[model samples]
Target chain A: MKKPIIITAALCLTGVILMGVLSGKDVEPGIVAKLKAKYSVKHAPSADHAGFEALKKKFTSPRQVTEACISCHNKRHKEVMRSSHWNWEREEYVEGRGVVYLGKKNAINNFCVSTPGNEGSCAKCHIGYGLDARGKGYTDQNNVDCLICHDNSETYAKAPDKAGAPEAALDLNAIAQSVGRPKRTNCGVCHFFGGGGNNVKHGDLEKALFEPDRDLDVHMASSGSNLQCVDCHTTKEHNISGKIYSLASMNQERSSCEQCHTAAPHGDSVLNEHTLKVACQTCHIPSYAKANATKMSWDWSTAGKLKDGKPYIEEDSMGNHAYMSIKGSFVWQKNVKPDYVWFNGTASHYLRGDKIEDTEKPLVLNPLHGSYADEDSKIIPVKIHTGNQPYDPVNKILIQPKLFSEKKGEGAYWKDFNWEAASRAGMKAAGLPFSGKVGFIKTAMYWPLNHMVAPKEASVKCGECHARSGGRLAGLNDFYMPGRDYSAAVEFVGKWLLLLSLFGVLAHGAGRILSARKHRNGENK
Target chain B: MKNIKEVLIYSGFERFWHWAQAGLILFLAFTGFEIHGAYSFLGFGDAVRYHNIAAYLLIVLIAFAIFWHLTTGEWRQYIPTTKNIAAQLEYYVFGIFRNAPHPTKKTALCKLNPLQKLTYFSLKVFLLPATLASGLLYMFYRYPEGGTTGSLTIETLRTTAVIHTACAFALAAFLITHLYLITTGKTVTANLKAMLTGFEDLEGTECEPEAEK
Candidate 1:
């Protein structure tokens, strides 16, 4: 009896809510599961292909779409022409792909530099909407023309709206034939698909959409919130004419993030007096959006093996891109110095200096969390030695990260029994030894050195950052001492080095002087 | 008093060794700071060169001083004692300001107060010994298994740097403490005078022969 009464009460409440919604009132959601169901397409665009055949059905060529796009967006077309995108397919005369059509013999693309025509179409992703796909017909018709997008086939006609070829939206009978896939699905078509032509850029296109506990595998399309193209795209800025800057517009900064995120994106205290400069992209990786990037790894011990007996790639339940991060670990042993570290991989679209060019020779990058780890199954050790910070790994020298930052330099070499033993003997033989804390004396930055800021992006480039041999982004500043210099053990090293050099120089100099005098005496005799 | 001058303020070799060792130690410190890239002195590279020379000179001077001290029985001056050691420490720390009488009086036969004995002894036995040994170890430091270390490990030579630095600061702190103690003498110039003239006048009559303590 109680159950029936409660059911009735719930039904009545739902009715009121439904009535309010019908009358245009905002409805508040309750923590209720009203038999929610999920839907998936039985089949999908190729993991190998981006369903470009559907695009081919709509437009004659990518060039036609470009032309239509230019017609609608005159101003944007001019800007696009100047952008890195326009330079994507470099054109020249007398090539087979050129208007005159020479054979496949003379194309100048990076992949097949001497091939013609289709080579332009093939390597189309080298620039521009290329960030979306190698050539997602962002070029073909030369107009922003696609049957799947904007229902262009309905409004702009196959043969210019003749009486016989009426648009499907207008004809009830043809509506069934023309009604196509939704807008969100079309957006994913490019967002998920990797690039093609010579270099396979972007990444694989057909990844599962809902990867719970794992990092998202989408590009400019990532967010904790499920967003439509217009949510971030906000206004249709008229600079692009009737074309309306949307997916095809490449140069626009995504001001949409500022609408919600309020965090100042940089390391704390990133300013000197009188400077209002900063960048958001310096630290935030595009696809790897989780707070910590280590979420995407797995315990290989339990994972099953592949046919080649290699472990099968398991999806990361956490956001860590173990595939990328493992390849980025740097260990400077006796000789290891890498040129660069690429924090992301084919999936990371906006991280500029991910490719840490030439730092690690025979650069080994495999697909774990996008880091530098060894092949097969070997562990590597990385010592996080801040160039100025010190620690004692032995005796009473507690080497915690906090110790280096705390005290001035007290525990730096306090437990280095070897150093203690060595310095003790020296002091016994000489005068006295002192002990104290050591700390960073005065550290400043050469702003344009290791980092750069352009409002939205920070370019932390290699070679550009680390610079020449022995030079550094964060150069050795002064040191603060609270105890013995060796308490921090940082200051004593140089004097010893100097003393050693002096002894060698003096020893040789004295020997030479004595030998010269002996020679003179022998001659006199 | 007439024969006091003939006892020799300090033996000729002892005086020479003291001045030379002090000069070399000071030179080592001056050049050490410049070499540490703290501030430019003789330029960075040259500072390193000079610091090395000074450090080696100190080592040699110290070597000679040790032999002299042992042979002439001067090493006994540094032998430590616990009698009145606590009182001597208190005299230097708190009593010195109050003008309280010293707990352990100094004399030609027993020059070091108990506190001074402990401190100076530690400098020699622990601090100074550690520094010298570390210096020698650092100078001779090289991988017995020669050839460049593989690219993934830190150089053993770098360890020397850390050890040497540890001792340098220890020595520096001692110098600062020593300077402060020097000022604690009866007059600002009194301790300096004793080392220079080897005579301390008493606050009592001329028969006492000490006008400063």
Candidate 2:
């Protein structure tokens, strides 16, 4: 008895020790502290641009500021000239369609259509000044707007309809003097206010990220790591590393979380294993459009409605635009749960004149190319922005409506509410045929969530995606998930087997009790 | 209790192995089902961690048990035979109601009846091996980069998980019947006491068949 007791105690001790050994050790606090310290370290400018003689002059035009910038940083303009920002397109090898130059210049989006006839307003986000309808001035080195990205003053902003020109009231001299590495403000100014409003295009890239708290974004939080956009999107030769798949087609020069945090950053091996096929953002970004509501759907068919012969705007309870005479009736969502898809970096786009295959279903503007079988693919969170935009039903092609122009009767849809006239002028500009009749076709655009990453504690829990019902990955049913899926036949058979065994044992026990009583009664008789 | 003879049936090491294996299997099943998403008790991360740890311990326990059975020549005790199997089944199904005698008798060398022998044999040879193999595959499904776990890759965990889950159900059913069968001894806890203390009281000294094998 003593030996057995002692052996059991020893076994128990062994189990306790095994638990300690098997639960993997966390990363060393000292190492994490060191990494955090290094991550948050801010860069000090090498030279004071304020003392530079070239920047001390009054700049008459935004183009003169670019001239002043190039006077000293002469070779920098050449690098900027070769960038995708200046060219507005990149030579990409599409999977099925060989080589094609795809970007804002020719790529047709569901929102605002394309940039061909709307370059006056669309080019406000462009890096160069005076980008005309043909995307000219890209060849000129002085057109590179240096202060737009490098402005540390956080006051530089492009005018609404100035063809990528800075606001007229901006003191260009002060802005050029304060120029340094790009901050969150520089990127967020255009990226956050995409699709003509704040938090409209990319649901995750929004105004809240300008000075995010740790709970909103761990990396960019001013009270936390306080990282600048340039820290992660490490730029070289004016070519930023991060690629937005909505406009990008190639797999090259894409920024990834693995660049900073290695692929296996978790202490537990199970989570590290998940990293093999699950993108970090799938779990990290629990929801997007955290601070403000984002545009979810746009119905352009309802755009022509006017109140008392005036193009007026209607707002929802959340103060988001419910209907705007220029754009359309809108659907806005806050704290939006992102849909997920398999993405392998490469993508294909619906170019300017591509014919629609099916008119009933929403046409995918930019289809990310990946599947379960793709080794490089991983499940990523995405915002699928759907719209009912104009298309030529007879030509079987989506129309690129001329959306923005300063003057009326220019065939701009916003100014002149005639879809036929707008479609004709827009197609003529894009060199595509458009029928006189116009129809609204449903369309979808995928914007992969890459920012506004929640803190470690706020990340998606395992149960959220691993449960049987209402799982985040429930739509992705092609593959099997552990907790969420199982063979129905197996479950049915297994359940019956367990139930029968229990019932059989109970019946047997009861029979034994009755048999004993019967035997005792027989003896008494 | 008078005129009853005390005999040692289960050895100390055998009893120790039995209880240890039982404890580990129960723990594994609890954690395994949690991982299968039947319920969430320990949380997924901790459940996976504990399951892997317990599985490793079970493997080690099994290795030691096999060694012990081989060294002590107790391996032959589980060699199944069809002889008297019908009579044993009949006794349980019908004859036991009339307080009938057991068709096969227990002894120190051959303690298990024919039905026990067959059940335990199948558990050790087929069900236990399948469960353990599938569990190990599930654990080491995807190896890290540059890992030398060569030529053992699997495309998916679906088949392995199904096999594992099915085996768990079978084992759980077997456990329920085995527990109830323990009460079918001479007294309610006769077999239980025998397993715990390695000693049991028999009716008569002559009942201890020296020529049982």
Candidate 3:
């Protein structure tokens, strides 16, 4: 009777499992087509600029191309003028400091120091033309380089040292006529090559992302979604959304993965619950700098060590610059695991003239603020770039060393190779007093990784962060995590209790067996 | 041998509950320890999923068993007594080895000895409840987004986890001792057979009906 019951139970169990498997495989018709229709790039321009009478004229200067663009779009120059890209500074209410205008103008970084003294070379990436130390170019509507962002020709190149002017060799009239919506090439030109070279600044962004595969970037994959920057960084009146925390202070106008994929995107309830405290990129973007090496460290103090008194570059086995006499020694890495941190979007910057209080630990250039107890805080992955930059020992402030110059003997660190002269010139340009004593202070900059999101299958496994030893979240100990955390005392007592019980049971059983054998032997006798 | 006779010590339902609960507890322990990262056998995700399912099943089993015990008035079997408790302890500790007679006689009316009653009572009342409650809390507790100061919410999983893990160890120890004690019956497999078939050999005692009030 029990044999038939057991067999029936096993059969029922198998039937339930098979039903579950078959149901999981069930998909709605046209689901793949629907997803493709929602995500595929369809950014063809509404109007052809080549047919426009305004753009047909021969343009000499990029400013003339701006004029042609303005004649048609008329009021767009005003919108661009009011943008942070045009002004290079925005009014922000920092936590400790009250309302203050902060941007690349006043903010100091460990790489290329600050933009004050090197405006001519640095402004090549700036949207406007003819930017100077005085920043008077902000008032000039004609200085806005429209073709750099809108040109479909993809041939519009900026002059290396012409204060944000177009390259002399470029056909401005053709580029002006070919103008269309901005593409990945437009943004990657400057953003991908930040900190003087490719993949040197933002570890997650680089030239490799121009035509990424699905494995490298699910959203921007050329064969997949093919999403452009503006798809997610939607703009209104020239003010772009999605601010980088390295430069941004306020939490306003930020883009998130939740903007498209809702907060509870995961099918699993437990995984969905994790979204309350964990950012999507923390798991999705498991490793960054997948295709190219990114700069991890730069020791500026080691600069000026020329190989035979001439600025020369030294390359490692991977051909990445290991040392440059003009800059310093650098440490580059690829496929790096990001350090996790609690971030709440809002950040505070170490301004150009801000005094350094703690010299023992590396100064955080832009401190991303959040804690476990904070309401808006979530665990986010960040690429921390560490370096040693020159500072004023007596003034207790970081020095904005003059890093670029056209002519020699202008106190440019690259040209003159003199820290004292570079600090003096750079500080003078920034309107700060130099104490004439230059010191290198270790500094760290946190760049939150947001792009190059891998496919869901490539995301971090539960064991990676939930394991007891060497977990990915081992650094974050502010809160208790299951599997990774337990009471040591309870564990010790519990282990011993189980061990002693087993020992006692074994000993008692052995005694019983021995006594039983002796009784059997006595009966035999 | 004083006329050994067959007696019903456990009802069919009672035996079913015992073995089902035993299977569930062993399965729970295996999955629970895996989820605690003791050793990765069934993977962490599967371990957690199976553990939670087993927990819900165990809770249902407990409810049914509770209802059965109350309706049958079989709950009186666990009313611990000091009578013959020391003698029972002595028999197990030393007398069993010398081939001495048993201290407490097993009958249908009173199936458990004093020491077994005390151990079973404490386990059913305290250890099991504490383990289940703490496990439930650990599974359900989630910090409110943006923070909360409500009494229902806990700031961390530390307390719930420690209690659950400690109870797990104690229960594991109980399982080892219980398995060994089953062999100490009239025969090596007597208790096992009785639990399976609902009958055991009892000598010098009236083999009353198991349901007799």
Tell me how far the alpha carbon of residue A228 in candidate 3 is from the true structure, in angstroms, after superposition.
1.2
Q: Evaluated on chain B only, what are the TM-scores of all the candidate structures, in order? A: 0.80, 0.91, 0.91
- Which prediction has the highest DockQ against the true structure? 2
> Quick one: ranking by lDDT, best first?
3, 2, 1
Question: Worst lDDT window (10 residues) for model 3 chain A?
Answer: A20-29
| lDDT tens readout by residue for model 2, A1-525 | 547655794776587557746565643245457669898666778999999999898877778888988788879998888888888888888889999987788888877778999888888899988888876767777778888888999888888888888887888888888998788999889889988899989998888888889888888898988888888899888888999988888788989888877766776667777787899999999999898999999899999887887899999999999999988899999999999999899999888778888898889989998877787889999999999999999999989888888889999988888888899999999999987989999999999999988887889888888877788999987676778888898899988998999999899888988989989999999
Query: Please, what is the whole-model Cα lDDT of each candidate in the order they appear?
Result: 0.35, 0.85, 0.85
Top-TM-score structure, candidate number:
2
Which RMSD does model 2 reach against the true structure?
2.4
What CAPRI class is candidate 1?
incorrect
Cα lDDT of model 3 by residue, B1-26, tens digit:
78778877888678767866787798
Please tell me the TM-score of chain B in candidate 1 relative to the true structure's chain B: 0.80
Deviation (Å) of B6 in candidate 2: 2.4
lDDT of 3 by residue, A276-389 (tens): 789989999999999999999999999998767889999987799999998999999999999999999899999878888998899999999998878689999999999999
Off by over 4 Å in 3: A1-36, B1-5, B143-152, B203-213
Candidate DockQ values, in order, are: 0.03, 0.52, 0.40
Order the candidate numbers by TM-score, best to worst: 2, 3, 1
Candidate 3 docking band = acceptable
